[model samples]
Target: MSTIAKEIESTMELNPGIPIKVLQDLIQKKYQVHISLKKIFRAKVLATKKVQSDFTTQYLLLRDYCAELLRSNRDTTVTIEVEREFNPTTESRQFKRIYICYGCLKVGFKQRGGEVLGLDGCFMKGPFPRQILTAVGVYGNNGIYPVAFAIVEAESSSSWTWFLQCLGNDLDLNIRSNFTFLSDRKKGIIPAIKKVYPSIEHRYCPRHIHENMKIKWRSNMFKNMLWKAGGQSVMDYSTMYDMAANGIEGGIPESWVDEVYWLSTWKKVNENTIDPINGKEMWTPSACPTSLLPPEHHTQIGRPKKARKKSVEELSQKINTGGKMTRKGKAVTCQVCKQKGHNKRGCKERGPSTSTQPTSQQQ
Candidate 1:
């Protein structure tokens, strides 16, 4: 194992998703030694552990992070809830949900106010995938200004209720607040909104309307026309009242990952003890009441999917490249010629023919 330690390390860095069987074969060919698959697997596990914090550590750190958020930024609301289980003095409680509304963003949203608030949630990808709900406000200049966000077990009515409750408390939103909420027809959101702010106006997003239409009528020309006909701009959530009704198991992700979702990563509490607002070291007391155990790992059935499902138009525009996920509705470009409509294999150059002048010789 020591002889090929560097080999495995480099390979893992280059392509972490390389199959274990393939790695085993490569080792045999290169090092001329046979190592058990179990041993190889163990090495890979140790390497991953070294790179990323496990679920337990991140969960433990979440408590301290909340403390720092409050300390550095005054009036910023950060709430965390965990399940109360029957355990000894040793075990940590399982995480239920967390809501964060930065003081700067909250104030900014209020000052540069708009009546409309956009709410949406997307799936967080990884070993212990969960839903992340967000409430985004529009800037006076018509840009997206995020007001608050929350990470919850699922995108359900109960979760939405809890999240909205927290948000209402911070923003002073009530039954008479009269703010317009723009959102999609998620299963739980309507009831949740009605329960929290019954009198407020609820609006449906045009993009979401188009998406719903796509499910029934799959047409590219229709998609283009819909966008051109109804050009629109974006999307809005809450925290805790109860957990008795929902029976979700608790713990969190087994590994650290990703760079694509910069906002997601930033919100995930990037390796930081420093507070972003005040630029101070965010610290927690030596001892505390809340001990959050990571959400429980739920092994999903079937192959895990990282990419989001594409609409019919997106699938139609893209040609299948053996086992590779295609970008949504993006034209394929050739690597060799950097031209659209063809891939590297079929790339070619075409230019206008030059005219031959035989006038001098003929004359």
Candidate 2:
């Protein structure tokens, strides 16, 4: 009975909206034991209490968690801002906004990540709701490299400014001339970015711009013009942008023609035979390796190091030659419906409809 109760509780914890009757039916089918609706309801209540208690425990331990992060990772920067109201009866501080960025990420970003950064915020879901803001960049492999994250009580100008300020300090944004930012124009992000990164190139995401455009003008030609303008250099962007801005039946806003969204602005910086990692111009032709074995494993007695390390792009090209066999399987097609996924045994289509004429007995 206790084991049965535990199963119901676990299910309810995963899906709080599960119906009590469904739990009753599931228990009967799976365990061959009938469970009353009252028992299922009681189990759900216990699970809810357990989940809430867990959240409370973690909330109380947040300070210790922040301390552990700094202690384990040296040079890590963490800032916690709290709203406090003094009460005569109870004298203690209440925690509020929390922001954390580990040191390893800062060091890694400086070493290997791209200069462009994307900023966005998402509303966190739970009993205690708040907004989570993130700063992300691309690495050599085109993967997202997270720089920092912050949890704020709301998404206002003050919150955004504070988040950006912390991020800028960690990333050393003062001297980042080549850096560019891409983001959807959230309520306060524009002002915050301008204040924090005065000279940095800030571009609105083209997807968001298109979405807003569709709300007013539903012209396919206008959208094509926007895409074409986004792909041109700064010089051509002006001509294409002006044509789209004026040529559209309902004119696009002048602010949308800003050069920040032009293809040249967001284009990836080319190394151009100069190794970005080592800051050296690479003019020499790459020598093909004579042996597959490492130098240390070679029987030769000369110096072990002769060739320069291969770039990630060079390694990826060599790796692509090694191929894997595709899975061997027979094709499946439903005889009844001629579909690929399912067989005729489980096809959902109803059989041919019965004749609409009444039987002779009725006549």
Candidate 3:
């Protein structure tokens, strides 16, 4: 192990994910002797610890790190909530959730931002697998402006509720905020938003809705219907009703609309309007608490995914990197049903008999 560690000690920092098989080959070339794949794996683990240290030690530093944010940036929020269980053997707490909203982001939102806020959560892949919930506002420049984010145990209703509540408290959410949420309609997020901001308008992402539609309907007509709601507004609806309902500022004189939609409004560009908070800060706790145990990740069957599963629409989109073309909106066709976007078990049209037909052997 020591010999193997010395061989790839430098490689760990440069590329931690370098495969064990690669390391085994490298060691063989360097030392002119063959090493087992299992020993190479053990050496890689040791080198990882030497480089990054134990993850549990990192969790211990979060309290002081959070304190630094509060000190350097006024009106910043850093909440750390732990689970109820305490191991007497280790004197450690189970980390439940932590929400962070830097003051700079809040200032940006307050000074100039659109009414629309996008919320989403995804799995945080690591030893301690959790969920990261994020809320970003539509910037004056139409860019994604980060507002707040939280790391929680799971992306469930309770966790979402907690994250939203923390966000609401920081943003001081109310009727005046007039914030419209746009989400992909994840299972728990809808209920959580409704609970936190009951009066606020919730909108769905057309792309995500279309992805769901692809599972059931695969025709070209089905795809076009997804985009029917959008486009130039026609003169069909009562002008008064259109003004009051569909648009934020319907058929307005260009000058009457808020400068948020205007690109030429540059008067405030020179000014330090909201005095955005400093993100770089350091704090050293004189006496820090006991380090929390590294959340044990039980080995699960099957290979773990590094990249997120993309929808057919996302996958079908042409890559601009090298100008590669793709067959747009195509998905996996179920062998049983001959439908796109699903496998045999997931095929709604395929019954048990029909599903088994593919695997049946001729007598």
Candidate 4:
């Protein structure tokens, strides 16, 4: 095989979903050899076959993976669920879902982190299509601590409920109102949280709610009023609401204003607590007047915005190079649903399926 072909194969194996153009650019930059898109596409096809084959094997080996995890980590928890349908032609059970929570991570979270939890779902852009549902906690040191994670077929009520249930069991939660959860108000999340943590506080990210409102009320005045409502105390929130409801040319919707009030109420309950991670006083829901909240609403309509900054590898490569890196246009085809103008992470195709079965748990 040619040197460029070898590099392409290696890169594809390392990052299965890398774009053809990205591969072409890297080869030309590193080896100073300009390869045609046709050749790159052919290499990608070969890489895709390898990726799919590996995923098939991975599904079959999931049982072993769970066993190995349990063996390596005492008191670790793991669960795997398979599709119910009988694939008579393949004569194999299809992969459905899996959850993992190491004992050390669970213990560290309980000891060092605050009661608040942040939950979100990310799309996995690999040979095996799935969503990784993650539960993270905030430490007193203002660090994000991983609590648990689940790989599910999609981010639906059933999947979220199962993940939370597993997390609750692993953490030995008391099923009380002490625990607070912050998340974007995704479709299945509210119902799922109610089911698993009915009494616990579930807070929506304010930024998300604003995006939904901006579509209808794009005025700068409306935007300022909405932000004021979020940052204010209960009394101030009501005053801001009145300004938006009555002051704006086209009054803010009663429904949207009401929801913001509800979110502020969620913040009012947080209390000040000692930061176990830092050994200093840290803002809990009660004491911290200004806690960072998640966004208000997630439309889940288009390519999801990147929540993180560039990595060290990316920054290092661009440091001395005089050439500038151009970002791709916002418009692109989604790899997940094969739709235009959206990326894989924001694909709207995977709605909550009615066929999702009950969640399974193992310790």
TM-score of each: 0.63, 0.56, 0.67, 0.56
Q: What's the true lDDT of residue 297 in model 3? A: 51
Each model's Cα RMSD: 17.1, 20.8, 10.9, 22.2
Number of the candidate with higher TM-score, 2 or 3: 3
Tell me the tens digit of each residue's lDDT in model 4 across 157-227.
Answer: 99998898888888777567578889998998999999887889988876777667767886768878988
Q: Candidate 2, residues 9-112: lDDT per residue as tens digits?
A: 66754555567798889988997877788877787677666665666656655555555556557778889776654654443345567788777677766655
lDDT (Cα) of model 3: 0.72
Name model 4 segments beyond 4 Å from true: 1-4, 10-41, 85-91, 174-178, 213-363
What is the C-alpha lDDT profile of model 3 across 308-346, one tens digit per residue? Answer: 688776665676655765545457888987877888878
Backbone collisions counted per model: 17, 0, 0, 14
- Quick one: how many clashes does candidate 1 have? 17
Compared with the true structure, all predictions reach lDDT values of 0.71, 0.65, 0.72, 0.67
Which RMSD does model 3 reach against the true structure?
A: 10.9
Q: Which residue pairs show backbone clashes in model 3?
A: none
Best by TM-score: 3
Shift of residue 75 alpha carbon in model 4, Å: 1.6
Ranking by lDDT: 3, 1, 4, 2
Worst lDDT window (10 residues) for model 4? 288-297
